[model samples]
Target: MSENDTPTTVSESSETKDRPVLKLNCFLPYQLSHLAETVSRSFSKIYAEKYGIGIPEWRVIATLGEYEVVTARDVSSSTSMHKTKVSRAVAALEKRGFVARDKNPDDMREQTLRLTETGIAVYEDIIPKALAYSEGLQAALTPGQQELLNEIFNRLHQAARERDIE
Candidate 1:
């Protein structure tokens, strides 16, 4: 793909004009999204089947694993998941006794979620596997390429954020 001519347009016909042609393989956004989903699914297998949790649950667990405590809204924002998905995942986790909800005294309607002892154990078990999977992916790139890729990813991420605000 030409970096300068992404989604390169075809001719504007004298007859019926066709829309611009975007090759999915060459489209940056599509490529990134596809890779991310593919990687997530692949990684989910490590935790999903053994732990009986899916993507949304895994995300919530990981967040709670990191922050120790957070609201459903916080999980939604952090994981870029919709609030409904977060709600459902939280419900599932709560039912499984992997998560506990502590009622907010100030706002009875709101609750903060924390991992149960079971959840922490799962998180701890998953960490080494997660790190190994990450290391395997990084092993595909040389040190220089990995560094460059990190910089490129950060730039694109920042650009997307700016565009989102606009």
Candidate 2:
């Protein structure tokens, strides 16, 4: 939202004795959440239509592509997805022969996941497309704006990490 835009002032609620004046449009968390969802949905079309996979599955594939071998728990941590979602995506990928899971030697109860040859080929094909898409988005900004955006993202992420509940 731009500074010139007027925000709806929310000052009261039915059950609240003391409610802070709130402006949803200008709220940082709300704006960030909306932006993230919009970007993810828009970007998902590229992989969704081509691979018939949703956000969770694509996240798993990307994580595996980067790390080569990881557990569902590891993917969950890296992708910030719930374990259940990662588990289901891993299962779908395994069924499609894009991923292989084996019992971890270090802990037999744990499963280790890796991409198969087919998975690697698909990932290789997608990498260039992903890079091109990222470049397309970056094209909208000047080099200085791009650097500033990256810096802002890093700072915000660090702040969020520091604010984690645990």
How much does each candidate deviate from the true structure in C-alpha RMSD?
Answer: 4.6, 3.7
Give the range where candidate 2 is weakest over 10 consecutive residues by summed lDDT. Answer: 7-16
Q: Which stretches of candidate 2 lie over 4 Å from their true place?
A: 1-18
Clash pairs, candidate 1, are: none
lDDT of 2 by residue, 52-100 (tens): 8888888888999999998889999999898999999999999989999
Candidate 1 has its poorest 10 consecutive residues by lDDT at: 8-17
Estimate the lDDT of model 2.
0.87
Model 2, position 119: C-alpha lDDT score: 90
lDDT of 1 at 129: 97
Q: Each prediction's Cα lDDT score?
A: 0.91, 0.87
TM-score (C-alpha, index-matched) for candidate 2: 0.85
